[model samples]
Target: MKKFNFLGFRFLFRVERENRDDVQVYSDTYQLKDRMVYFLVFLMIISLSSQLGNIFQRNKYIDKDIIKENIYAPRDVKYKDVLKREAIIKDIVEESEKKYIYLPEIGKKYSRGLNEFYDEILQIKEKKIKNFDYDFFEENYKLKIAPEIVDGVLDLSKREINSQRKDLMEILDKVYSHGIREGETFITTMAGKDFKDKELSNIEFKVLDIFTFPNYVYDRERTKFEIKKRVDGIEDQYTTVKAGELVLKKGELLDKEKIQVLNALGIYSFAETVLRFSVTGIYLITVSVIAYNIVTTKFKKELSNKNIYGATFLVFALLFFIFRFFGKDYLYLIPFETGFFLLQILVNSAYAFYFGIIALIYITPMINYDMVYFVITLLTILFATRFLGSVKTRVQFINLGIQLAIVKLIIYFSITFLTFGVSETVLLDSTKIILAGIFSGVLTLAIVPYLERSFNILSSFKLLELGDLSNPLLRDLSVKTPGTFYHSMMVAAVSEAAAEAIGADPIFTRVASYYHDIGKMKRPKFYVENQEGGENPHDKISPFLSALVILAHTKDGFEMAKKYKVPREIRDIMLEHHGTTFLAYFYNKAKSLDENVREDDFRYSGPKPKTKESAIIMLADSIEAAVRSIEHKTYNNIEEMIRKIIFNKLEDGQLKDADLTFKDIETIIKVFTKTIIGIHHVRIKYPGQEKESEENKTDEN
Candidate 1:
């Protein structure tokens, strides 16, 4: 057989025992069962993911529809209003003005042309030419100045001409300063308000217009660039719909904008509907796979137990339906922490934490993935698991609830205020969260007993209750078989110590030790412990009968435990504590009487201890009895007897099935030795003890 061990869990490939083919067959059957469990878990996750995703999907709506009732936001929803943003951008772009550039060089060039035209007029006048060709000057200058205006300028004296030229230049400077666009007639350019303040004759205005070419040229690329910049500067329009805020009023028209708000609140459109399902399905599958890997690698022991595994998935399913049906409004009302509490009690705390986190992750999307809720609830679960470790009483559950409530309040306010600031809604939600924390504790207390009974789970609280000496069974043992009761108490003490030393369950070991010999109460006088100076009952019977009487206690204790509703684990301890070891004293006595007497007849009908706690109880019970029987009360004597008893049990093959390692055995031996030494330690003499002893000896002499 090949074996693999990971984190204290062993996986065996095959069994190689001779004449035990049934063992291999059982292994194969278990493997099949394990695989089937994995398949069923996968199927359940897929089915739940599909169903729950659809359950929370929003109802469809179209544009321009009239809503008969009001639609409110299920959760605090903040989304970029795509329709509104686009509309705003479009309006801004359309309202923006076209841009233009001013060319001062155009104005300067036209001014120089006017100055040269004046110089030509002076030359025409100085030449005293009759019938000067004014049309030629107009064509050459590309100006359509009136012939009379040019002739009037030419006939002016030199002083008047300089004054006219200065006035024309001033008019041109004023016109170009304001800029003239291309394709405007000179009449229209001079008819504007800028020229209204100027006092210029028609000829002068004409001269200015002829020189005022379009100084401002339209820049196509610059205009587009400026318009784009203005559009980019417009911020994205975002709409934040608070939880429980109205999206649309009754009798209101559901326009595109309102439909968008609904969609942002998870009221999906056809495309969003498809997307939600696909994304949800993929997320669930991925998280489930990761969770599966974590469990198989870190919690192999929990995975082997069908009940724990099944119950875990059942809790997951319950939480999913609860969150889906209640929606986000009542998310805090559900006692999510109760599931973690139950798991911590029923399973180990580590497994509870892992399962709780995974379940939280699985259900977060149902609540719109509210990160504050997730983080605070996750902290509460963590606190519950860590604080409620090994519950000894129901009161601890109540205390845990109060602590968790306080924790939730502090965390809720801290996170909420930091993220969303203070609000009436936040304060109200915090109160509900506190209530949820308290309710979880109460619910856990209510549910744990039923789960423990249904699953046959032996929780620490159950163990503590069973371990109480006031219980009817223990009371009966104390009254009817005082000697056995005392011996059981000593065994419990040593067993508990050994269990703690070996990292086994001390509470379970101690509790099992208390009930391991309860059957001795049935016939107290038949055993030597309860004989109390009376004649030995076994002396009157044959060795076979004596052995039978002695071995009957294991079966008797087992039946009594079952009748009293003792947990299966404790009852198993009662039956398997003695194992198949022979009654050595009786067997030896019987062999002397009959040379052919069989050892099997004197041995216990045996299924040996199958757990570390049970095995520790067995060792503690034997060592306690053996040490008490020693007449010499010395440290070496007690230590030597303890080692001998453990070695005897080991040599007899009684612990082969106990699943105890050599290291655990060594630790158990050391603990048992120390405990027994304390129980049998020599007491210091009191101040008058020696004198009292001497006086008593003198009186006797």
Candidate 2:
């Protein structure tokens, strides 16, 4: 019996696996369904329900006049706009043109310019008005104010006399006018009778100029915008079907209007729900099974069952509902990249891109957008992801987002240009789409670090961090055991070359190689690398004891690596650098001393190299130590030594776990030979030197 929680419910299950003999294999823990599986089911159920809402609801909207013919309403429905039209209010909206409302400052500037030019005339006029300067006015212009003449001066009524004086004024009326220009053409347009005040004589009124510079003004750019906004926008234009209204007859042909009313009523029947949900469930299960097959078969090491399901949940959660809802309507604005970005970050680039294609293809029938857009987006994502092969940095990832945005913008513009031309509305939507692409990339940067921490996955950025040689364990090895450090460096160089030749991750291989032999550092003097002053510690101890001391490094290195918080991949390399091969020299020495000595007791405890990097490190470690030990070096001799090391590892089953091919091994051997030759090349002796050396040797004999 097994207990499991699924979708917030606990259940007891009886599950059994059988062998060839039909005996039950215990798999209670293995068979417990993970929550991520439940999440996928939950996600798909909701997405399917959302889709059914559309599928059951009718939307075949086509307007037709039935005034002449006998066409009845379809089953009760509301009117809806099925067509995705650019709001024709575009015609009403004044083309995003700006009109500035000239502030009070504009009028002030106009008035100030007029005042600056006619300042003396205005000032004299002001003084003349205050002092009643009839003498100066008469001398300058041969004009005089008709202030009721001298007769009214004796019986002066202040209000009447002042009105008469102002009515005869020429300067005040000529200098400033509200919204009137300075020329006669504009003055004639204004009402001339208004300037003819009854308080003054006809001569005073005639002498006065009718026009003054217009002061009230506004900016056309600003005012035009205000007018356009007030003029047009999206209006409430939908038609609704009242309850119990006869939408259409059953036998009537389904046109656009009848379909819309049925859609609005959410015309769901029990039979339709069952059929649609059943179809959706089958679809969900099919794709899930294929994804599972790929995950188990191809990405077992890189991803766990939980990781695969979790990533699927993320993709569907980002995609399914959005497509089921908005994708049916505004499919052009659908975020194709949200799930794609998360997939590439949570999973690998290749997995993310391929899986994204499968998901997009599956949903193409449901969305309203053109298949061309969907295909273009899928292909673009594949290119962007594949282009970023293995090496990735923050900046490169950001630039990738920019590239996606640029590509999306170009594609969208091309489509729009072909279909509708570059209108204001199309350009506006294009900006939104291109921004979504860019946001996909930027959001990746924000989301990845969290997933990396949660899953403890090794991203390219994390790999780069581990590739640095200044880590604590490596620094200690370099200082306390310099010879071992040199050996490790040589191993790293060779492993990196071999890795690159074989299409493995060279950075990871080189990094793992640097610390593959860290266990040996624990017993530095026992091995050849760290012995000081020509003294050997292993010589003083029994060969059996020496083997035990040497074998303890793998165990010790694992503990130290755990303490230093070394990444799991590097730690794995350390543990598997040497397989369970017998320490031969010590085992043979022990056997010669005591014939009862056992080989098993002298073997190194190992799980063997489980990945390509570890396997390459294993080979490089053995070959570097062997070639470094040789005092006499030649290309032919070095080649034989390397071939022996490789064949022995192959025969002993140490290479069984890694994914290296025969072709890969052969390529590695060639690269290793080239690298070793470069490292250990010897200068050829000249003929005279060789002869002289031989003659000296003969004389000494």
Candidate 3:
């Protein structure tokens, strides 16, 4: 019955170590649950942002329709055709047998002179206005004409000039009255009647009005026909009309580029494109930071250093191109799975699942869809999957991945129906995506074994394995070096008590104590344990060799731990438990034998225990061994031994680098003394064991 109860107790203990019930696993401690909760909150924020982005993208905000119209649409029309339409005016004149009206050379020269004078007048007027002189005006700005122009006009056209002489004289008189001088330059008809030189005084010429021969009115219908023909001609051929004039042809409506410019300023669909670009970019960056936060927070074994956080943030931001280029909606899910897998290996699965939900929220915005189902499914797997004892098997992790995938598919199908009415096709697509996620998750799990082996990382499983006394290395030590093994067990007990008292890590102290002196196993007889009736190996060997051998244990122990692939934290305590403190007995013995024996050679090479818990173990290991050296134990002897060892280590500067304060050392010593007294205390004899044995024999008879 006792054996059964003992076995049951052992089984229950193992279950506690292995059985990570999802809800309790994360929440079993407030710290774990809080981190998981923060992750969920982060994910939800991402989901909301993603939904908002999708809303904006669908609405087509700020879609610049003008750019499309003005910049890209005008390549079809030919410039040569536009010029052809303008040349029809010349055809109309040719058909009328009216030589296309052209001012004579002398008239043309005068006109050019008049235009030049007009331009100068306008520029001077503008300058006057800028100078704030409102009164400024040009009263008699004039261009002088030459007297020889009258004969030239007559030589050009006799009959035509004669017919239009009266009208041309009137026009020339008006021109002189405004700004022209006689005899400098003059106008003539196309037939070259020197009208300017023919004029008498300005009054006589004004009465004749030679330039105003007949107020010829072209037929309105004929003019329209002529204008249309000219337009078509200009469209068909390259023609230069007067500067800055334009011709319109059939099917030509308006300046399209100008219309497009107006449209871009929110005129045609202004809200759509602008909003999509703005919101999509926002969602992309938001999701990236959120995803980075979730993965880095979840997978990271330690809290983030600035460099790691910065690097991860940068990497997540760069992932935007992956989505834009490849159209992969589920790319972040790869990192998400990796984060969860790392969390499980480093911390616990329940927290990992929460992180997955957070990642899902982060991804929702990038994919422009809500990932609530994905988040919930991940949580469900985190809750459902058992992560304790039996979970160490690789096949179990694979099966868990498969299970999680199926759960995810179901959730996705449900979500699809809830968000956008369900269909067989949607379900099928969800399944396929879920299968991909599962494959990624399994691949992540595949790395766990290697990480555990290569990094010597101790999971909760490894810790539990170390706890079992049946472990081969431990069992052999217990048998061959019983005293040392017994000493280690007692140290573990006291160290655990001391660690708990000082608010140090109890598990770390316990584990360190268990493995601290594994080197003593190599030459058990040289040490106190397994010495039996044998002569001291030290007596036969030189004091230097004995000191060397004694000091070698700390190094030997570290190498053995390395060979066994002990985790780094544990190896630290193993190597540093003795620090570089002198093995006083060996050192003093060497000193007594030879004055030249070096003190450094007899000391254990150490980087002193740096953490509070490791330092406590170091002190505990020494006190445990030192107290046991007393043949007859007493409270005074135990107290003196504990104080002396701790004080000696401090005095020798072995504890100089350790973070143990005087207050902590005081508490640790008190706890250590109390525990030592209990372990060494003699128990009262069982009152009736002998009497009961005799009574049991008589009763059996």
lDDT of each: 0.78, 0.65, 0.57
Worst 10 residues of 1 by lDDT: 46-55
Ranking by TM-score: 1, 2, 3
2 versus 3: better TM-score goes to:
2
What TM-score goes with each of the models? 0.74, 0.60, 0.47
How close is each model in CA RMSD to the real structure? 9.7, 21.6, 26.3
Poorest 10 consecutive residues of model 2 by lDDT? 22-31
TM-score quality measure for candidate 3: 0.47
lDDT of 2 by residue, 1-701 (tens): 99999999999988887443323223322222344356545655664665566445433233452322333333222233543223445444546444322244433443343233233333434454333445644554444545453333324355544554444333334433334432333335236536443444443333333213233343665656665565544443445454456656544665554545544554334455456567766886787667556645565544444555555566576677777766644565665776776666555677777667666755654552245567668767767776656536777776776777788778778865665555665676677777776776677778776666665556666666666678777888898889999999999899999999999989889878887777777778777778756789877899988888988888888888778767677887877898777689998899999999877898778888888888999999899999987776766677789999999999999999998999999999989988998877654455577678789999999
Cα lDDT tens digits, model 3, 310-364, are 3223323333334333323343243344545554655556555554455444554
Question: Residue 532, candidate 2: how far off, in angstroms?
Answer: 4.8
lDDT of 1 by residue, 1-701 (tens): 89899999998898665564667557744554564457446544644553455446445667777786888886776566788879887887789776677788888877888887787787777775555455755666566767777776766789988998987887777777767886665577777646565576766666666666888778788878988888787666666678788878988878888887876776656666777667767776787778766766787766667676666656666666777778566877788888888888787789889888877887776676678888888888877777667565788777787788889889989876765566767777788877887798888889878877777778777887898899999999999999999999999999999999988888888889999999887778888879998999888899889898899999999999899899888889888998887899999999999999988999888688888888898888888877777896666677778778888999989999989999998888788878877776755456778689789999999
Candidate 1, position 157, lDDT: 88
Give the candidate number with the greatest lDDT.
Answer: 1
Model 3 residue 512 CA deviation (Å) reads 3.6
